[model samples]
Target: MFRKEYTRIESSTQHSSVNEFVVINIPEEDVEPKQIILDPDDQPMWESAKIVAPTPNSAIIQLDVDDNFVINSTHLKMILENKFDGYLRADPHDHIREFLAICDMFKYGEMHSEVVKLLIFPFFLCDKAKTWFNELNEESIISWEQMRRAFINRFFPPSLFNRLLLEIRNFSQNICESLTEDWLRLKNMLQKCHGHSLAKGVIIQIF
Candidate 1:
């Protein structure tokens, strides 16, 4: 039989070599989390900062308008005459279409059509619409398409868009209404929806 031997390990705390030792007291610090304050000027591009901060020199929209390119006062007057005041009954899509129709009549001297639209669009807003336009982020709108899309998205939200779409999808002709009247009504609904993806064949089939 082989003899087994066991080796015991001693704890360093129980068998400390040096009898002398120093315990320097370290005071525990009561640290509090720092509250960071951000200046509005530091966050110029932030939407909330833009809204609350005063920016007198900054324009909400940045246009590619040349300093020398001046719009005719008469044209502006004409546009302002038919200003769209955002109200309960006002259809944003109809307003935009009407505005475009009016703008089509004028040709500014050497200025791009897009520039003309951008310059004249602001004059076309009044009352609630004008207020909404004024509240846009500084230099947010750069192009006519951007302005148009933003305008439509703001005024004609997804809820209104879906309602219009549903109306088209479930269109019903009144029992006593003439076919011509019903057709005109359906056409008007289509116009309001603006970008409904229903095929022409399906639309004719709906009729």
Candidate 2:
């Protein structure tokens, strides 16, 4: 019965570029192991593939026609489930705030692993981030947490805090700037700098 079900799923999925079979009720020994398929649409590939080996949060897949590729587990899962649909797909550099908001949304949904995967995808990563990502040895990254930290460190280095602090300290109304525009700019920067804790005297001096 299990084999029959598995064969049916497999036959239906063969024509598709990616495939998955949900195993159920089969005894461990009797189950015909089907290699996991990493969707080719997620990344450009010469051919479709079947998982040859899995390590931690990634897998090595051999293509049907010929070739091999390594893909992260979270990415493979998302591809199989069609969860990558409707993503904002912005360039990370030009749309840092937008990408960060998307990341936060995913984190709130408890999909941290998927967040890292989405950020690192070539289509989503900015030119600078793509260069950095290409330089790293993919196998060395063992977890989503490490990937997230590396990405943040690359784009939002600790130096940003210092820059923000300097901006806030030196903020002043320019002679040619409208008072309303200046005040709004200062308020926004202060929010970024989290300046609510600054003394009232300092705030007054800036104003």
Q: Which number leads on lDDT?
A: 1
Compose the digit string of candidate 1's lDDT tens values, residues 1-207: 222222222211222222232112222345332222233333335443435656543234556667788777877888888888888578887888888887777776545788888878988999998888887877777787888888888888889889999989899999999999999999998988878888999899888
How does candidate 2 fare on TM-score? 0.42
Give lDDT: candidate 1, residue 120.
80
Candidate 1 accuracy as lDDT: 0.72
The residue ranges of model 1 lying beyond 4 angstroms of the native Cα positions read 1-68, 109-112
Model 2 lowest lDDT segment of ten: 57-66
Predicted structure with the largest TM-score when compared to the true one: 1
Cα deviation of 45 in candidate 2 (Å)? 25
Local accuracy of candidate 2 as per-residue lDDT tens digits, 37-63? 333344434334555575432211111
Candidate 2 regions exceeding 4 Å error are 1-97, 100-122, 191-205
